[model samples]
Target chain A: MKKLSILVGVVVIVFGIALAMSFKSELCPYVTVSYVVSKGEVRNVQVNGTIVPNSTKILPNNTLMFNLSDGRTEMRVIYHGILSHYQEGIPAVVVGSYYNGIFHAREVLLKCPSKYKVAEENYSTSKVLSKG
Target chain B: MDIGYAFLVCSMLGILASIASSIAYLRGNDTRKIVKRANFAILTFTLLSFFTLLYYFLVRDFSVRYVFLYSDTHLPLVYTISAVWAGREGSLLLWLLYLSIFIVLSTRRLDKVTAFANAIMCIVAAFFNFLLLTSSNPFVRLSFHPPEGYGLNPLLRTPEMAIHPPAIFLGYAGMTVPFAFAIAATYYREEWVKRARNYLLVAWAFLGFGILLGAWWAYKTLGWGGYWGWDPVENSSLLPWLTASALLHGVIVEERKRGMKLLNYALAVVTFDLVILATFITRSGIISSVHAFARNKEAYAYMVLIALSLLLGFVVYIKRKDFFKCYHSYRLRERLIQGSVLIFALSTVTVLVGTLTPLLMHASVTRSFYRHIEIPLGTALVVLLGVCVVAYRESILRKSVLYSLAAGTLAGIVCFALTKLSLASLGVGIFVFSLAGVIQGYSSRKIDLRRAGAIAAHLGLILLFIGVMGSWMYESSYTNINMGVGQSVHAGDYTLKLNGFREVNGNAKFDVVAYVSVYRDGKLVGVLHPKLIIYNLMRSDRIVASVDIISLPLEDIYIAMGGVTPQGVASFEFYVVPLVSFVWIGSILIIAGGILAALQRREEKTRKGVVDAEGEG
Candidate 1:
């Protein structure tokens, strides 16, 4: 019984360490377009912003190009697949890497417009963090 | 609208009175009479409030705010009925209605233990009632009437809404019964544990099936051709069930009562608290999900509920310290059960941590993070499941162990050959071994509901693991395929040919369909028509793709169209997945097993009562 207890304890500790380490390695900060630009060559980060109107173009290969703005700055986003719910002036979270001033997105998630959702005037949380 | 609000307020008052009377009964100052009457009155009032809201929805009363926002005259009758619980306020009302009925049924006869539990439930009922009356009242009236109403979301116009939300809410409400009993068992005897076990099973079953139904809804909607996205809301919904799954194991082991009795009590409180946490995540919009709830400041009421539950759990634990002050050496069976419970707990913690990392760490972790930690843990669990079966070797055939190992090894070989992924093949081996343990439960003639239910549920679990592994590892996807009419493309070894396009103006919407045929080695295998549906009455301009899935004996073919142009050029994604059918089959078996295990046969009840009454006395 004591050995079993020790074994259970050991397994929990090992798994716990693995989970913590992987979580750290995999964590990507949500940043604004300005922050990404300031950082320069940011890898594995997500930027939350509203899609800029009349700035979307569908490449012949069905790749989508659009400009995303966090109000203060705009970054061009190059995505390789459909946005599925893309609309002008809609909030979106684009995840990938930033290099040479363009955000090449591996994934795009659009926040669908709803009567229920409160229209947040800002998507930037970096300012609040620095202030805190 | 006014009447509904009035009934809601009355139900809250009734719930408070019931709590007060239950306390009096526990104090020996009153009979269970007033408690029973108050519960019945609360139920009646809640029923009246819910029906009044449903009446407004059915009548399409545009003057009512909820009705005006969610339903229209053109909405189908079933969907309109479902729309009563579609929004935040309406869904809370639905949850409260189910809670009230369960509360009334549980309080049919109350002793000191039961009366205490009845009080705790009344407290829970009062909290929901208060939320409904103050912040989230579904009966709020509009200042002026509009000519028409904004119909339900195009995404919610399907038959899925009519069932999925309701089932999930029922599961949440059913959880309250066990939570109350677990708290009551803290200072009292073990009687509450036996009673609560059945409720736990039933609630756990409902939650399992509800999640599966949500997955089915997602699959039908064709989001990334994947049923699970590990979204925040999805993970939150899964969190409580994991803890409840722990409690499900804890209850059976705690019955010996050497020690570990407090385990169930603690797990039950945590399970119920996670339900509140799930609510907070879903409605408070603390995390980003495709099923985003609008963030409401008043939804912090649920945080208060969690605080209350925590306080309630500790206060009872402190008061009952003497009851749990004994220790005994654990048997091998008990130790094995403990090991599995620990695994369940770890899985819960991992999910809960992953879900909350965004809020606390200011970082987002994607599906890969979950897949990495969870798959290994799941494989370990499969191994633990095999070990745990040895504790119940009495009911199992000794020969079945050898048979299951052979079967499992064969499965691993086949998996290795098909996917060439060593990890999946390893999973197949352990999963089949554990699955054999489940089969061992059935091969014996002593197959009662409890044994059969456990076997079936575990069998479903093994099948689900196989389905997940196979579907993920073996599926072949061809994306962004643009084909003109009569054009063909190769999808793995199968050739997909776009045959033609047809438009049908159904009563609900205009359906633009693309006919496609699948051929293997130049012989036709199946025909598929994946359609793009544009609903006319939806408030939003959205075109939803209705996916086509053909289930073959060995594999399933899935197709979804992006759109079809006027010139008959079709763009779509084609996918074929091996063993995806096991996900659904496993889900159903798990769900049915939960309900079956909860059933109380006639003879066993009397015998159990006699045994328990003497033990406690």
Candidate 2:
């Protein structure tokens, strides 16, 4: 039994370490507009920010060009695909690389926000149970 | 709204009362009557609360906060019914309804462990009721009623998304049966594995069906021209199904050799735990996913549920270590079964790690990362499953494996000749090998319900993987095809002619439909009407690409209208996705196989009972 447990433990540890290593290698750091500007250039990164109002334009070659800002810094973002779920003023997470003073987005994640939100309650279930 | 809230509290209190009564009954008291009454009360109150909420949705009552948020008067009656569980709070209530029903069914017959299992189940049901009562109440009414409700997200208005949540939550609730049984069994040892066996299969089938529906929905609506984007939320849902699949194999091995009992118990525990984990991963916004419900501290409540299950499992396993028997000197088939379990565990870990990297490392791994692990591991799993099934006949092991390898090589050669892709050919080879093994097993085994179900499921697995590989590796896509009226483009032996475009203004929505004609070798096949829909109510007037797919012999011709400019130039994308139909067909086969397998077990148990009674006489 001891031997079997040891064997299983060693296998789990080795596998976990291997997964961590690969995950680290494939990591796409979520950076901000300021971080991208300061770092000069970064590869395979994601930036979450709202689109600058009236900043989105169609380029000559049908590419989309917009300015993504993180409240303080704004970066020029270019995408080569159709933005089906994108909306003005809603935050989007853009995944790609930053180079040549332009953030080339490979994928952009956006959602059309609903007018009403799921209501939140501040009371606790445990407190109710205790009182009962 | 107040009545609904009252029913929720009543259900919670009833569940608590049942738990206490069950404990007293277990402690040598005649509290069975109280336990039975409490269980009835729970069912009544849970049902009343569910119908109360449903009534609110049916009437489009904007005074009820959840109904006001998710349902609109414009929604169809079916969608309004589905909208009851569209949010976090309402879905928890739905889950409790299912749990309470199952709890009433399982507590009908009181046995030695029945009280304990009943207590465990009541506790879980109570937790959900508590959630509905406090943090995420669906019945919290507004001071003044709004004139109309805010409509649901247009993306979720489709038929598949409407029913997907209920199916998924039902499966998750069904899983609690096995968990409570497995844990209760450890208290006083018996063949508790047998009791939970059918429940496990039913829940596993429901989950599989739900996942398949989600995939189909994604393909139809997501406009991505592909199903399964390797999203973290999708991976979380797949986790419990994997453990349940592994547990199915473990049960057969245990029944055959009376060994691997410990492994089966552990798998049950892990399966339930993963369900909880899936709930947390999907509902919580800690991980980036397309399907995140809401981000709040209340989502952490699911974590406490996970810890409770895990802690219960751990304490039970420690205390009942002697109950789980470990046998030595296993037969060859038993060893093969172990290989299946090991491979399943590996795949589960791979998915779990990939799903969690976003949280642990602050980085979500890409689809490429998943493909790297999944393809190789999936291949190994297929090969092992085939080998294990055929290994039931001891003498032909070497011959079958060798023959399967030969068939694989031949498939690889043919695939290479057709597609000229080595990796694609190699995958084809692996698929052929597994199919051969399943066929060989059928040839040897007698044609009973059990054997027939197993073969059908194995065949489904083979077909599904073939679809996955063919669609992933060999799909041909033509993008950025710009066209005006009467323009035509050739896409790999098929020509797409843009006849024209027309605009349709329906109630509250507008659509731009492109009339595209398809031809194969100068023969007009069919015309596809791909549209871009814009919901008028949306402030952005967002355009959602509605895809149209035409099924060919072994592939699909998928076309979508991208956008139309004012200059009359339109952009479109066409993809020839091969063997995509096999995915759905195979999934149906697998679900049918689960039901068939469970039915066979029930018949076998009855037959055994008759034989034992005859012997006793």
Candidate 3:
């Protein structure tokens, strides 16, 4: 029984590791870029770029956009979700395939500067106005 | 006269007195003289350092560089005093002071012939003082003093910041007591492990509370909606905590059955090593963290020297096992001891590997040198732990194995349903392990409450894991709306109406408050007021979300919004978190159980009989 339990534990652990590796492979793919006349889906490639908000001229609608520094490559993301508290000058990670000259990001990660302000003050009020 | 110079000289003098007294006691026949003088010197040095730092902050002395960088006159008096520990140099000084004070208190409380313990503690105190006097003196002066000092970091000006660091330092400094006792146990050839177990429990409690407080501060203040990023600094604190936790359990085995004596000694040494390592990781710029202090080469050199010396002592002591072998003849119940040792070794390895992985990756070696290091070590650790919990209940291997499987399956099912199959299916695995924990707890008849605390803590980890998984996977969020004072928006089965926003100006910050009402299923549930703060000193801003929570037995409806917009539209995010409160509540129970275990006096009537039985076994 002891041996059986140990074997089960080991198998469960190996299963977990295999699942992670496969998930990573499927989610991350290498792709080569082409100056698309239209949209294209590329596989397994790393893309680096800076983030710019869409409609920066308006108040609160500063939806994040990735301005790829490599030539004129760019992606405007109308995120199907909420905008995190990320701003300009912060680093971001985006993973997805390109569609019709635009990068359709499936996962977006933003690393914001750690806030060191004391707890008493509320920073959310300014966030609403800024979000607009 | 420079206050910095005065304090530096006083600290040096106190170090000399402590060392001289400790050596005298160690070498001489009479220990009373050395012990009394050493304790008094430690107290004097602590008071002197405290007052000097206080004066620097209270007077807004910009001539002192530490003060100039971390404090200002406009800061509140409470925060001004806390500014003493708000920066690197001052915090190191605080660490030294706390170390000395703890040593002195421990000396006064001990009545036994503890010359060896006193000497070891004094040496540790001397090392900290030397570091302060030479490398990271808080009293250093600036060549050109500015008129006003830079204010404390806006985040650190909170009450939690003031309380948390001191509590953590106390916990860290408190480890020296057990370290000293262990040394004394080795020197005197006595079973001091039993007595020192209480100190270990205390240290564990303080460190546990300190970590929890830090997590709470991060959750509410950072506006990150989650706690615990598994950052290096957090992991560093956790390393000592993990070892100390294992040692706390190991000590129980030693006290009950006189097993794993050598393992106990190694744990004590490692616990102290972790303290030094944590300090080194935070103070040195080797790793980037939210709490990384300014790097100083002198401080780094001092820490390296101390670490090397402690490591050397450990090696020499372990090699000459002759000193620790006097009690080796007494054996513990083999199965219990083996199970406990396995838990300790597994936890220690997991923490050590987790802490060193990033460093190994960034080392100035070939990439392949560290390629195999990034495996999901935490997952393996949790599984091993699951096994241990199941095994702890049964004396026989067969019974334990059968019980573990049954419990694991039930836990897995519950976790799957709770997490709602978000992201990776890891929650199912974790849930199975946690279910085993509940079963293990129920099966133990002779419930060692300390063991109960350990079980509770494990259960808490499982709940926390589930909560994090559910929030990450199944949780949905969205933002972008323009609403007037009477405008409304629908989110996740709820409608939020922007009632209004008001501006509130405090002495330290300006707040823009948003008031919003929520209706669920056409019934008004509650109101939430989140704010955005503009700190006057740092000229920085942060978004503070107000959350109105309707906590059910199984899940929580957490509503938080940024604030009311200029057009009266309020922007908000709501989270339907499952089993979130269990994480916090379980942690409290764990701490309470630890305390209960610590206070339960050993059954004095059974002690001599157990000792005799150990001799026979």
Candidate 4:
């Protein structure tokens, strides 16, 4: 019984260490837009910003070019693939890298702000809903 | 007073009734009478409040803010009725309504066990009532009604809404049953564990159904050709579920073997507390999720306080040594059960830690982080499933061990040859053990519902794992292409030819549909219509992709149109996934099995009564 307890303790400790180490490696999650901008050229950075409406252009090659603004600065975002929800003026989170002043986005998550806000607000009117 | 005011008054009355019930239980005099009255008052008022809200929705009363926010006058009647829980405040109220209903339904008899459970439930009801009354008052009146109201999110306006959220809330509320029993067992000197088994199984089944429903909705509407994305909100629900899964096993060990008593108690309390944590993650704005909730510091603080209280209660209970002591020896089957429980415990911690990481690092935990844990841990779990079955009551003999290893190796070889994917091959190999386990369970003569349920549920789990392995291993052919009408695109063995296009206009939305023909190895398969719908609303313009899918028994051919340009060029992405239907089939089996197990011939009532009476002595 004592040995079993010791075994359990060791397993928990090992898992705890693995969890801590995961944060430092390439397996580390993407940083936010502010974090990426603060530390230039970090790969797999996740930044949240609003797409500048009317500034979206779908190139003939199917690459989407749009301008994203984080309230302070606007960065050019170049993405390959269809982002069906990339409507104008909607907040979006882009996961990828920033190189040579352009945000090379791998995945673009459309944060359709107002439509979802109404539902959340009707549920609890305390805090304003945040852009995902 | 208006219905809204009356609703508020009723919830307040529920609070008073809860307090009265708790006091009566503590005093141990006429506890049954007081609890019954309290239960009646709470349920009646909650039912009235629910009906009043439904009435407001049915009439499209734009004067009510919740009605206006969720339902527009032009909305279809079905969706309008379902929109009652489309908002945060409405859902919380709905949760409380389910709690009251469950309380009324579960406590069929006025016994000591029921009274104690009811007292605990009252406390939970009081808390939710307070939350509804303060932060999420469903009856808040608007200063003025707008000319037109915002309609429900086009995503949520589905048939699934009629059942999904309600089932999920019932499961969440039903958890209090086991929690009450666990708490009572620690202090009340009663045989509460036996009674808890039914409620625990019921809640577990309902939660499973809710999750499956949500996944089905996502598959139908999200146009992603996938169901689960390991989103924080999804993980939050899964966290409690994992612990609850462990609790289910732990309680069984406690009930029969007189072991894992403390572990069972801990799991029950943790599962209930984790539900609060899940609510906090969704409602506190602590983490960003697709299902976002309005952040309220007071609500978040209340959640923390509740969780802390439960934690403190657990700590105090564990201080008593006998509760934590194991009274049985570590036999082969016992070891397997305990080991599986331990694995589940580890998996739960990993998920909880990953889900809460955003709060710590201020960045979301990536899917890869989960894979790092899931890949290894999930593999171990699968392997252990086989181990438990093969090594079940038999001693660790060299011959049997070799036979098990030989079977696993053969399975691995067959899987590798078939799929040509290594990780999937390993998963398949482990699944063979699960199949054996099921066979063993059913091989017995005159199998009862208990044994049958366990067998069916385990087989379902095996099928689920196989489906996951197939999809993960074989889903490699995919492409994003833009082609004009009459142009063809080729992806591996399949060729897609754009045939035609059409436009359909609606009152609230417009759809642009593209007709595409699919050919496999020069043979015509089918024509698919993939459409993009753009919703025109006052607040936001939402674009949703309606996917066209060809679902076969073995695989699914998926197509979704991104958008069409003015030059007659249509952009669409297509992919094929193998054995995805099995995920749904397996989930159904699990739910059916759980229900079957819970409903099987009631545990000898007189025997249970004798045990309870003896325990009391």
lDDT tens string, model 1, B1-617? 39999999889888988888988887788768898989999999999999999999988898999999888777889999999987888888988899999998887877888898988888888888888888887888888998788877766776765787788778888899999987886668555667777778888898888899878877766545677777677788899889988888887766655467677778888999998887666544446421122244564577788998989989988888677665766656567788778888988888888887766665778788888888777777776676566445433435656677787899889979997889778878878788777656456435667767888887887888888877876778877778899999887888999999889997767898889999999999889989887876645545677789888866788888877667878888888878888988988998998988888673685576466436533
lDDT of 4 at B484: 94
Q: After superposition, which runs of candidate 2 have C-alpha atoms over 4 Å from their true positions?
A: A1-21, A85-88, A113-132, B284-286, B289-295, B538-543, B601-603, B606-617
Each predicted model: what fraction of the native A–B Cα contacts (within 8 Å) does it retain? 0.35, 0.24, 0.12, 0.23
Q: State which candidate has the highest TM-score.
A: 1
lDDT per residue as tens, model 2, B1-617: 49989988888889999999999999899998899999999999999999999999998899888888887777788888888877888888888898898888887888768899999999888878877888888898888898877766666778998988887877788889988998997778877767777788788888888898888888877655678877766788899999888989998777656688888888888888888777665544235422132335565677788888889988988898988866555766777777678778888988887877655653567777777667766776788877887776668888998888888889989989998988878888988899888887778655656667777788888888888888887788876677788999898989999999888988767899999999999999899988988875533424567889998769988987777879888888888899889888888888778877777767676576465335423
Q: Is candidate 2 or candidate 4 better by TM-score?
A: 2
iRMSD (Å), candidate 4 = 6.1
Evaluate candidate 1 and give its CAPRI docking class based on DockQ. acceptable
lDDT of each: 0.78, 0.78, 0.59, 0.71
DockQ in order: 0.36, 0.21, 0.12, 0.31
Q: Per-residue error at B243 for model 1, in Å?
A: 0.8
> What TM-score does each of the candidates earn?
0.92, 0.91, 0.75, 0.91
Best by DockQ: 1
Please give the ranking of all candidate structures by TM-score, highest first, separated by commas. 1, 2, 4, 3
Give the interface RMSD values of the models in order: 6.1, 8.5, 12.0, 6.1
List, residue by residue over B493-576, the lDDT tens digit for candidate 3: 778787888889887678777777778899997776666666666433234343455666755666555445455555566566
| Alpha-carbon lDDT of model 1 | 0.78
Model 2 chain B poorest 10 in a row by lDDT: B285-294
Model 2: per-residue Cα lDDT over A1-132, one tens digit each: 566568657756765676667666667765677888888799998777778888989865457889988777899999986654455676666889999999999976663422111001001111121233
